[model samples]
Target: MSLIDQVLARAAADPGVRGVILTGSRARGTQTARSDFDVTVVVAEQARPWRHSTRTGTLDEVVCTVEALADTSVHWRRYSFRGAKVLLDRLSGGIAELVDRQATLTAEEAVPLARANLDAYINQLYRCVKSRRDGLADAALLDEQESLPWLLETVFALHGRLRPYNKYLRWELENFPLPDPWSVVLMPDQVRLAPLCLFPAVESLARRRGHADVLDGWGSDIELIRAFAGAAGP
Candidate 1:
């Protein structure tokens, strides 16, 4: 068996470990030579704190522990080390289920920051459209252009204190970026860009709500942003 498989087998020896999840590029099967394994160790109790440890191997290894298996509210133990594989999930108890959610735990932004992000994305869209209309048809708003909806969703999420995951949103909502007119070219049939690109929109969208009813509020700003973004003509 491979080294990854062996490690997973070893982890299974412990009865307390409930599951193991492999995320990042490897779980997506897009791992490169430089990619390392990210494993979450799920245990039966959250109150148990952990000390870190390193073990020798062809792969760099580290282990952390946390508890309360099968509980929804407790966060899992996170282990990240350099190695290109799934070492093991050997919990004699059972296999830990994997939950793939992004934007899992973000606090909402303040009103000022949210407003700034909204204005910034709208203004960026306007600049691109204005430039294209001015005949720089080749100009595109390439930066911070893809985070529009998730940003907006932050407000929507804050109505309930949930961090809406963009990856999951893509599966459900046909959302737009903090869109510029050039978004058509940069994001034709795509959802979610780099977190860096989505940064401002994420901050602003949540901030606009400012602890208000995000769903029931903020319609005007959303409309205004859309109008500015869509002004580019064919």
Candidate 2:
């Protein structure tokens, strides 16, 4: 049997193993020759040692109980299962269905997340600007680093989309993308230029979504940054 098959057979025979799923690059069909299998085995209540062998390549496994999986606060693990492929599901509680459900966000969830992300982005933008004005190049660079992810998350939340892992960001942008000019500015290398490109788009989205309060004063802030950079204000 193949490595995957053998692994599934072992999982199916375990009474504690409620479900088995394949995740990571292999599950997503983006694996390289050296990519290892990332399997998550969901159990009833307790965790167990991960099974692995060099001969069959790495079988990176995580053991979690159904209760933990059901908890909304346990987001990272659920996010990992978003693109997972189910191998064996014998749990009567519909654990596999729960994994599938976490792939997307509801509008209610997206709105607050988007607002929070925008708040964080604006805070970071201010820090970046202040650091630059004060001639703290290192501080400015650090602020910029902190700002980018917030900006990306804000954009994704505004569009009601899940933010993919960093490795899949380029692919996600190429295939899904945020919206017009916004996506153009969200490139990894264009971090410094993001505020200049992102402000107008964010302002528009905030207004359209009745979130104007969340982005209040953003226009003036953008103008201030642009003026400081010797660029024409929008």
Candidate lDDT values, in order: 0.41, 0.70
RMSD from true fold, candidate 1: 9.3
Among all candidates shown, the one with the greatest TM-score: 2
What is candidate 2's CA lDDT for residue 128? 76
Model 2 C-alpha lDDT per residue in residues 54-131, reported as the tens digit of each score: 333666767767666666654444456656788877865486776776667779878998999888877887787788
For candidate 2, the lDDT comes to 0.70
The TM-score values for the models, in the order shown, are 0.42, 0.80
Q: For residue 180, what is the lDDT in candidate 1?
A: 47
Query: Which whole-number lDDT from 0 to 100 does residue 40 have in model 1?
Result: 51
Clashes of 1: 17
